[model samples]
Target: MTFWALLILTALLIAAFLGYAMFRGRKNREPAAAYDLRVYREQLAGVDRDLARGVVSEADAERVRTEISRRILAADAQMQAQTDQDGPPLWANVVAISVVAAVLVGGGFWMYRQMGAAGLPDQPLELRKEMAEALRADRPSQAQVEADLPAAPQPQLDESYAALLEQLRETVSARPDDLQGHILLAQHEANAGNFRAAYAAQQRVIELSGDAAPADAYSHLAEMMILSANGYVSPEAEEALKQALQRDPRHGPANYYLGQMMVQVGRPDIGYRIWIDALRVAPPGAPWVEAIYAQLDDLAFRAGVFNPPNIPAPSGPSREDIDAAAALTPEERQEMIQGMVNQLSDRLATEGGPVEDWAQLIAALGVLGEGQRAIDIMKEAVDIFAGDTEALELLDAAAFQAGIAQ
Candidate 1:
């Protein structure tokens, strides 16, 4: 009420000031012709005084008086002609002032209504952090969120593939202890958008592997859970992520999901930092890398970073190296390739390259029949790109060629 009263008083005072200025201007305004007429009349009176004091002859006084009277008549005529043209009419001036006042007051109110938070009080940083914490603490559980979600759309599958999938499912159900069968079932179920079944199969895979289950198994389970819940990270998924990180602390999927969970829980600062770290090591074309790149700016803004630093693209072999290798003889080419691979290895050890370079090196080592060396590099690459589905696929292909992956 007090604010409203003050606003109204301020507006009225402004309008009154403008009105007074206009009225005073009109009242004080004297036409140029009218001022000239007044000056001419004063000069005529001076001439009469001069004649009475004998300071001028009669003829001179009469001539001066005639000339002054002629000037006064012309000035009077010009003033009469300018009377209506001097300024806008009183009513028009009033309307103009009223419109300006109305726009000043009413437009300001309209603009405020559109952009201002009328009822909300200003929140300090500490208070905002406290509120965010409270919101995080009171957020809905996984089950609750899943219950509210609509059914997922089923993916279209060819009849042949569907029949094969059904057979695989039946075989896995009957065998129960077949680790390979469960892995296949999990992969195919996830491909078919049957996340619930996918996660169940993945859980069985983990159970069968027991303490030997790799970080990927747990991460895959968490991924399925998240997909089933439409991207919501449940306590169940978080536990899986924790298990994955325990086995391989740099697991990509686990870190990505962890960052997502942080953002969902009103901790964008933590989320942004986690994502930035992940992106630094992520291979080019990795699914998580692309996803993070797409949303990084928005995430940074929410994290209160107005200008986030750019993430450099991963470097690979130069065209000159490729052209030089291509020009070599067969035996020389092998030697050149080995030299290039050695250089790449040394460079990666000193300053890491993109996942593509890592993949290429692994493939090149396998081609050179360096099985053990390839296997060792594959292990290190796996740890670096853990949980990143696409990057893992590339590394797995290179490992397979090297006879290191089954």
Candidate 2:
């Protein structure tokens, strides 16, 4: 039945029940009718005997008999009035009980009709089958589901990268003497976003290559060091850079990175010279040459030095202008390059030429709360090179200038 229908029926049933109770109370009369004549006579006789024996006065005896009669008559009249009222028949009571039972059963069934068999506790076997079907909908048949489920869903990237790093580690461990393996492992670690492991792996490469060979090993080591030093650099990684540099002074990456590290640790002049030397030895169009040159520019900028001084502009067409006074000679390129080097040297000699120049500028600017400028200069360097010494030196200088270093 609808909710309203059930409510109306319940109210009617309650009213009927109350009416029946009231009816039964009226019909099942107490023994309030007149007392039996035999009992009354006996009681009156006993009272009379008492009066005759002088235990009571005739007036008192009469009063007691009269009072008792009055009470008995009042009780009998009340009982007879009660017996005259209406009451439920036995059949009516039985029907009410059947009606209540039917209401309860029908109401329960109506509510249960809204529920599905999926919710039935006795149908667990069916529920399992449904769940298996759901899984099959999303997964390929060939893919195996584990007998034991995971506590929660795992990130695919997290799992994939973690596995890659693990494989790289195993490869490096198995081939301890393979410098290339270490380099590959380091790159793998870097790709997997594990900078610390990458740094360590690069350090291993430097160690395997030793002092004389593998010019790029030091450079890679320096890259790792710079990355590590940016809160990314670890002490162990720093040690690795040191080892790489120890293997070769002219190792381009090593010299550049170590020089920057040195400046970060408060040796800007050495850092500047190292960067300059890196630029000098680096071949044009070499893999890392542009990066080295950018670092030099960055260093000059941070030192508050702009362009180099006293290099006459090229006099003729690009090729001829770069040549020497001897027209037939191939000295133009050499002269132009020398002029460029001289220009770099002159700029280095100015107020903000080298590490010391940057240090002074950073300090002076810091005192004036020009930290943004200092930071700007450093950022410019970072923009030009991935891991340059000049950039590192400026980072250190800025930090020191800002009173970050103790």
Candidate 3:
């Protein structure tokens, strides 16, 4: 109900109460005048009979009858006045009812029109449900996103990464005899952030090399495995590298890799010991000397127990060391050193480090008295090297020695 409707209803209720009060109030306002008409008539008739029977004087009867008639007339006039006092007007009642009805209907219609004009919509369950669903559907899972990815052309980096992986796989599979291929595959996998896969590939190389020439393969595989292990090298991998070290106590790569692994695993003392061993075994002009120095500095910083002085700047091969190596006769030294170098280089080719691994394989073949195989390996290396002068010269010399050239 509107304000106007409430006001009108209140007015109607008040009027009705007032009317009832008037009706009730009027009940006891006038006193009761017991003018019993039947008693008056009977008493008058008895007086007349007495007058007729000469039982009473005429004057007395006449006076009594006149007094009784006066009382009756007064009573009738008072009753008429009482009946006409203070009744509610019919016109007033009709007007009040009209006003109440008008207020109720008019207020209701006006409110309805105002609300409609303002576009006050009703609450919709369907719209609320749809909004909830839309909010929930906006977010998708990783698997869902991957599934919805379009067949669009890949970016250059992605394409190159995929091609590199495919080439590595093909090279590994096609050239099982080529240890260098497996090594390259492992290196590429490492570069691509697949450390586990790289470690697995190196492990295969170690397995293939067997006991005869496992030093370099063990070194490479141990390096990758330790790197993959992060700061906690597995006991299994650690033991494998130690076994390799025992076989060739002066194996430079194995010692260096193991030292690095030890440092990573929070064994700085052991790492330092292994690094010292590495320095002693590695040649004067070894290629990895600078890398070893950096590792030592890192381990020392992490240990925090005692600060060690920086390793002295690396120097070239000492004159004394060169002179001592040169003192031996060329033929005898070549024959002896060639055997060691061939074994080491063949291991390097299998473990996959340098691009010149194919040439190393050729060198090893020639040293092992397989001249024809050496010639073929050299040709393959030349084909791979293409415009490289060193590879061309090496290939020509090997071919001449094998009697396969003019």
TM-score of every model?
0.56, 0.31, 0.35
lDDT of each: 0.82, 0.54, 0.60
Error of 2 at 199 (Å): 2.9
Mark the 10 consecutive residues where model 1 has the least summed lDDT.
397-406
Off by over 4 Å in 2: 1-165, 170-181, 203-215, 231-247, 292-298, 301-406
Between prediction 2 and prediction 3, the one with superior TM-score is 3
After superposition, candidate 1 runs with Cα above 4 Å error: 1-116, 313-406
lDDT of 1 by residue, 72-149 (tens): 999888877875546888899999899878977887678767877666888987887788778767777667887899
Cα-lDDT of candidate 2:
0.54
lDDT, candidate 2, 1-406, per-residue tens? 3654665576567656765775566566445354454466677888999998999999999998997787667666676676443455656766776676566556655655655332345646457556544543443211121222233333245777678768868877998987656766776666555555676777676566555333345445546544534423333444556665554455555665666554444334456667666666653333344455556656665544565433222222344443534464557655654565445434644533444344444444444445566565445434544466644544453444243322
Report clash pairs, candidate 3. Answer: 183-352
User: Which should have the higher TM-score, number 1 or number 3?
Assistant: 1
Model 3 C-alpha RMSD vs. true structure (Å) is 36.6
Count clashing pairs, candidate 1. 1
Q: Highest lDDT: which candidate?
A: 1
Residue pairs in collision within model 1: 252-386
Residue 55 in candidate 3, Cα distance off native in Å: 99
Lowest lDDT 10-mer window, candidate 2?
A: 140-149
